[model samples]
Each structure stands twice: as structure tokens, then as C-alpha cells.
Target chain A: MKNIFERNVSGMTERLSRSVIGIAGCGGIGSSAAVSLVRAGVGKLIIADHDRVEPSNLNRQYFFFGDIGEKKTAALRERLLQINPDCVIEAYDKKLEREDLASIFENADILIEAFDKAESKQWLIEEWASVFPERPVISGNGLAGYGDFASLRIRKTGNIYFCGDGKSSDASGLCSARVAVVANMQANLAIELIMNKTGDVK
Target chain B: MGKITVNGHEIDWNDNMTVRNVLDRMKYSFRMLVIKVNGTIVKREDWETFPVPEGADVKVIHLMSGG
Candidate 1:
């Protein structure tokens, strides 16, 4: 009983379905990555964010105009379930503190650091690495402005991976095209990490 | 001059060289960086005092993260 979605991602669905993914933001990267993961048949997602959808966020985020003013995690969860009614999404509309991140995403096999601030990204990664030294945490970085898309890439050390240009400053402004590319790269890297860990499981 | 490897390339390392010295020497101005010295992670606040022993393997990774 494979629908177009499952039939298309035939090889990955099972392993992804057994995995629980955690994303720490629902802005451009988190929202876009969450959509891709759910569509790829990741069975559950634990997403958290303190921001609400802003009208300007439509330029890069995966939210519709009507979603403006709604909490991002909730809005994204709704959008995800609309695509796959069976997918279980736990959307937390709050700022994730150090302990909150550990308790909330305890079951997540992998995590995505999708925040927009440098300090935030660094601290989030530190907390995750401190708690789950073995689990992989994927991130998107240096994706600012447009063109030179080829410069974007995935860089890693131990279990922490970054997918982006590695030097772009956010002052250049965020654009839809480049943002989507990095967002998808984060999602793709998450899938690769998960598959590598589960390849021998099933 | 002593030596150390940073991101796989060996570089001149003076005695009592701190992480800040290595970062400044390498001109890594990127605001976000994850640095490891001899397989042990260095906290940002300790970069000034943390010592890099001679021949230590250091990884000064520049990280860029945003939406």
C-alpha cells in the first residue's frame, strides 16, 4: 500500500519511519527541514520554537500567509500532518533551555540546530554535545544572500555537522532560494546520518 | 619554534600558546567557531587561558548557523 510519497522514497522510508527527529527551531531551516523529513516518512518529529510566524517570514519560511501570528511549532506541525496524517509531531512553542532540550528530545535519534543566532547555535550545539555525545546534530550555517550556491557544503567533527557556506554573514540578508538549499542540505545530512546509524538495524 | 597541526596543517607554535593566539595567528575572524585542542573541547571563556601543548592537534572550525 505504497502511495506516491512512500513509493518514491522506497529505500529510505522504513529506516526513517523508525527514527524520531528533533529540530530546535521552526524558522526557515527548521520549517523547511521538518517538511522534508515528514514527507520522507520520518514517523515522528519533536520541534520547539518560541517565535510566531511573521508576515515577512514568508520570504523563506515554509508557512502560508494565513499562518502569520501563529506559533511556528504549532503551525508547522499542522502543515506536516496535512501532508502525512499518520506522522506524529510534538510541537513545543517555547524557548528550549539546556535541560528542556535534553528532557524533551530524549528519544530523538538525531537533532537539527536550526536557530538564527550565532550564540544560540553555539550554545544549542554545546548542550547537545554535552548530553548526547554519540548522537548526531546537523546544522545549516553561512547561508546568507544569493548566488554562489556551490559554496554551501557539509562540514563535521565527531558527531556535530554543519551544512552551509561556513563563512557567510547574516547581515547580507536571507533569501528564499539560498535558504531553501541550506535547509534541504541540513535535512539531507540528517537523513544520511540516520541511515548510517541504522543501516545495520533493519 | 614548536609546531602544532590545525585542521591537519602544521604551523609554528610558540611555548604557552593559547587558543586565542592560534585563532588570531590563523586570522579566523568568523564570529562562530568550535575549537578542539588535543581532542578536548575548549570553552569560549577559557580560550584566553587554555594552553595548547606543543605538537597538539587543534581544530579551529568556523561555524555559520542561521535560518
Candidate 2:
């Protein structure tokens, strides 16, 4: 059998290496999705999250207690690089505004909207559609409390993937299991988009 | 009237209705959700131009996060 890196993907990996994806949040859904995309061989990843890894985040977020107080985007970048040394990971420990959206999204083949705020998520949907109409953006939702993994679904709005319901993360209580499941769903949708596999929707 | 299903709920659809337009008609609050039409996922870009055919089965799943 061929070694993993030496394996032939016929430029699939090369093309993906050249591709850039922007993920707005690095919390529950964002962090988890980032890990998956890294493992999937996505070329480049841009993570933007102003929040720091907190003790509370240890339960659901990917960061450890040791990483507490560390900016989510920065920590995620370090971790992802540890796994895929060649992958280019960028970290932005700041919020995204209308002007910054374009720059952040520039050259990215796909955009993953994982912001914790519903308003910001809306901003991505509108801005990407109006300004960068050709680019594909995926927004996540409904990953809160303790719910069955079956509840999560992936649907396409145009080129954007709306990965869940607008269910408030504040619904009752938040748990790691819920966030992990939804984040995986979001990551799966992104991979499928990158692979051009659209025969099925999850 | 055309018939279609959204998020498991069946509803009436109008002629030449795009997914975004239908979403608006249903007051789906698009920001909080994703829509699936006839097993194919429709993204935000296709909302205005993508047409929903008659008797098409559509599903709209909305996401919510609980604290």
C-alpha cells in the first residue's frame, strides 16, 4: 500500500492545499469542525474567534484546561498544525465586521460561518451573498442542550450550507455531546462540499 | 395550489416560487435555518433563482443553541 503522503490524489490534495476556508467561531462547533477539516486535508484554514478558552469550555470545546485563557483561534491554529504540519492555519482573535468580511473571505473557496452570535451568522449570509456571491458559505445552528444526533440535518440555501436550526444554545443547558455532534455535522457538510459529493445531504 | 413539505410540515407553494421566496412566505426566519428540497440541499445563493417544482418534497431544518 502507498504511504499516506505519497498517495496519489490527482491534485485533489494539491488543489485543496491551495484552497482556503474561513471559520468565524472556534468554540463548540467551530473548534470541532476545524479539527475534522484538518484531518480531511483541506489546504488552508482561517479561524477567527475573539473568545479565550475558558474552564467551562473544557467540557464541550476542544481546548484543554491547560489552554484556558488562550485565544480560541490561536490555540486551534497551533493544534491543527501539530497534526498537519503542511496545512496553513491562520488565527484571528477578533470580531468580523462588514469590511473585514470581504478580506477574511478573499481567496477562500468556502466559508464556514460558526459564529456564536445569531446576528453575526446573519451578517455572513447576507454579506457573502451580496458581495462575494460566487463563494459558498456554511452556517450552523441548533446544536444545544442534550439532543439526539438524529435531530441535526444539512441543507443548502443556495451555495451556502445551513447546518441546523436556529435553536438557541441557551436552550436550557449546553453540553459537550450536543456541540460535538453538531460540529461534526457542520464539518461533514464542508467536506462534502469540498469533495463535490452532493448525491446525499446530511 | 402546489404542495411541498418543509421541515416535515406540508405547505402550499405558488408557481415560479424560489426557495428564498417560499422561505419568506412561510416566515421561516432563514437566518436560523437550512432548507432541503427533494433531497438536494439548497444554499443561500440559489434562493432567488432556484425554483421549487410542483409536488416537490422539501425539508427545512432550523438550528438552535441552548445555554
Candidate 3:
């Protein structure tokens, strides 16, 4: 395992291979971010979602036709392992409840909020922060419609870090290209935090 | 008695000004927002009750994406 990762990846091998990330919601953002982190050599991931893939998810989510009936967390775990066979993935087959966050994601170095509903997004963020005040929560918001790619951005409030234009409502429409951009940005920020976390070499 | 700032703009602050009141004053009807008052996060459920004192620095982030 070490030999394969050594050959495939370059810098921060020791750090990434030991890190653990937690993600809530297995939609486009969560699915894509998990893949990118695994490719970047993140050692473990804990993903959860209560929904099953439907034909509609193909528009932006990272799932195949065969994954249509599979639960999102289960399907995503399979996909992540396919990329890094040794990478540890703990997939829960249910939506996250506020009370389950600390116990489920206690070891997560960082948390990602990828839910679609406005209320869900707000609820998870605040709940997670209340439980893990020291950890950061990366969120995706406002990547909807067309020709306003610049509308998407990143913002930080205390322990909460979010990415979006803060104006684009997904209810109106969500473009694949824009969603991918924000997903990658969230993944990139996660990498940055892990790499720059001041002596986190475990 | 004094005023508070929201996203760099000054708004008149009054007694018993909660986070919800500020949102209404600013006309921020967006559903996905990350609000903070003086660097302290104000949860969505607490919007109606979280206090925003005079001269408090508030951040009302308007989130644009859903998933």
C-alpha cells in the first residue's frame, strides 16, 4: 500500500495517508469531494446519506447507471475504494441526525456539508459546530443557473467555512459545470487545511 | 441606542435587536445564510432570539447554492 501511494502521489504522503475526513450528504458535492480527497491520498473517509440514487442524479452527481438503486453512501464507498483499495471508508446508510454527528464523526479532521435543501444546510452546519467547535465545516452553496460562474465564492465565519456565490438558488436551476467547480473548491480547501494544520503529522 | 454593521454597511441598531430583526431590516430573505454576530455563529433556530447588541459586527452571508 505504501509503495503504491509513494509511486502515485508526490508531496505530503505521510500526512494525507493518515488523515480522516467526514462528509454528510452524498450528492454532487459530497461524492465529488470524496473522490478527489481519496485521489489526493487521504487515508480514510466517513460518508453518510439516506437517499438512493435515481436517474435524476446523473446530471451532476458522480454515480453511474448501475448505482441508480444503491444507497448513496454505499455506492460512494465502493467508488472510493476502487480508486485506493487500501483507503479506509466508513459509510453509513442514513441521513445524519444532529445527535449522531459527534459520535459518528468524532475522529474526522474536517467535515463537509453537501446537502441540497436550504434548511438542511443551515441545520447541519450549526449543529456540527455546536458539537465540534474546534473543527471546521466546509459547505457548498449558491451554484445554480447559468453564466454567473463568478457568483460562486468562499466565505469563513468563525469555524464555518462555506463556498458559493450567496445568490444563486439551486431551486431555479443547477448547472453541472458550476457544481463541479464548487465541489473541487471544497476539496481543494480540505487539502489545504490538512496540509497546513500546524504539526498534524499523525 | 447605537448602530451595528452588517457586511461592512452600517445600520441603525436599537434595543432588543435580534438576528431576525436585522435580517428583516436588511431584507435578506434568502433561506441559506451563515449568520454571525461578533464572530459568534447564530444558528438558524436562534435567529429569532439571538441578541445583536449595539456596535456588534454582524456577518449575514447569503448562500447561493443548494447541493
Candidate 4:
């Protein structure tokens, strides 16, 4: 009699156990993504973000009110443990710098770019393509404002899977539903990538 | 009139134009943003059919990278 998670993902777990998921941001999308990946049974996660929880984030972020002001990486790491104790969660509570890119991404099977800053987003994508060409990275956009959720499109770009709309919440204040919808999709994309569900040619 | 480029070509400017209109004219379907306009950062909302005065300098950069 094992947990539902363990039972449902046993096969995926064995495969994903060796898979390492790297997320660059732990705000709305990253936090929700971490939860989804844990539920999906990704073996290991490296969560990094240099921000603290704010009252404004509580509306969309999965974190509770009590967790406000806490560092996002720490909270994600702690909460992910509750969802799947066996899943290894590594938290790096700092902004991703170019120097940290190679070492941080050394073992990642898949990378999730959830950074809120546009400049950081550009750098990570550029660096990964040049330095870590083999690893797959998933990036999200356009989960902001109140638009038709149907507009969300998941596109594949080379080794990168561009999730959601590729738009910024900063441009259109993020709503709970939209954030959840996009983040969930991103998580599912990560799971599919790990499970080889997308019929990847490579 | 200043030249605004997307990908590479200069875009025509008019008061009637919006960001979406400009994007439509460019025939670009890829998600665009994390962009710069003459070295200045422009928001996505600004790309939504926002009319540009004559002679506006522009540059469009995509959000995701391959590396």
C-alpha cells in the first residue's frame, strides 16, 4: 500500500529519478511548477530565485499567507519535500549569474526559465544555447492580464520548449487562474519531456 | 523619420499604427519581447498597436534563447 503518487508514477519515477529539473525563478510560475513536477515525480529539482515572498505574491503564488516574506527558494524547497519526500530538492536563493550557469546546469536534464527579469531571461537562454546545447530548457510567456486562456500556445524551439504565451506578467498583472493555467501547462510540458511523451526525434 | 527594425527591416511609422499592427505587418508569428528599441526597453503593451509617431527607432527581440 504505497501513496497514490508513488503508485501512479512508479515507472516515471524510475526514469525521472535520474532526471534533474532546474528552475530559475520561484515566483508564481516556478512555485506552481515545482508542485506539479513533484506530483509528476521528477526525481530531482534545483530551485533558484533571488526574491522573497511579498503580500502581493500570495494571491497567485502557491505559498500561504504565513509564508510571506520568506525566501522563495527556501519555501519551494521545504514545500516540495512535503509533496514528495523522496524527491531531492536543492534550493539556490540567489539570482542566476553567468558564472553560476555552467556549474548550476551541469546535471540538469531539463531547465525551466521562470525568471521575472527580462535581461536575466535573455542571458539564460543565450548562455544555455551556447554553453549547454544538449540540455533541454522550457520557457514560459504571456500568462499575464485577463485574456482568453485559449490563447496559450506551447511551441517547441530547438531544444527549448516555449510554454504558455511568452508574455510577461509585469506588463499585465498576473491573475490567479491565468498563472495557474500557464504554470500547470509548463509543468506538464516538463513531465512530458522527461517521459518522452512528445515523440522527440532527438 | 527614424527607422524601426524587427528582425532586420525598417518599419513604416504612422499615428494610426499599434504594436499589434506593426507585428502583423512584419509577418512575425513567434512570441516577441524581452526586446529593445534603439537600445531602449519597450513593454509588450507598447507592442499592441500603439501608434508610433513618425521617425521612431525600434528593435524587437524574442524572449527565449537556445543555449
Q: What is the two-chain DockQ of model 3?
A: 0.70
Q: Which tens-of-lDDT digit does each residue in B1-67 have in candidate 4?
A: 4455654677766556666766677776766354344434445545664555555555554663211
Please give, as one word, the docking class of candidate 1. Answer: medium
lDDT of model 2 at residue B64? 53
Going through the candidates in order, their DockQ values are 0.62, 0.24, 0.70, 0.09
Taking chain B only, the TM-score of every model is: 0.92, 0.78, 0.93, 0.60
TM-score of each model, paired residue for residue: 0.91, 0.72, 0.93, 0.73
| Residue A40, candidate 3: C-alpha displacement in angstroms | 0.3
Model 1 residue A122 distance off true place after TM-score fit, in angstroms: 1.0
Model 2 chain A weakest lDDT span, ten residues long: A1-10
- For model 4, how does the per-residue alpha-carbon lDDT over A67-164 read when each residue is reduced to its tens digit? 88898888878898888888888888887897888787677777888765556676676667557766777777667766687778896545656666
User: lDDT by residue for model 2 over B1-67, one digit each (tens)?
Assistant: 7687776677888888788877887897646544557756566667778899888877666555431
Best by the DockQ measure: 3
Model 2, span A1-202: residue lDDT tens: 1143455356456545556778878987788889988877777888887788889888888898789988888888989988788888877888778778888767677788777666566556667766766667887766667766666777666676767545546546678887777777777777656667443221
Task: State which candidate, 1 or 3, has the greater lDDT.
Answer: 1
Please state the error at residue B43 of candidate 4 in Å.
Answer: 20
Shift in Å, residue A23, candidate 4: 0.6
Query: What lDDT tens digits, residue by residue, belong to model 1 across residues A87-117?
Result: 9998888998877889999989889989998
Which of 2 and 4 is ahead in lDDT? Answer: 2
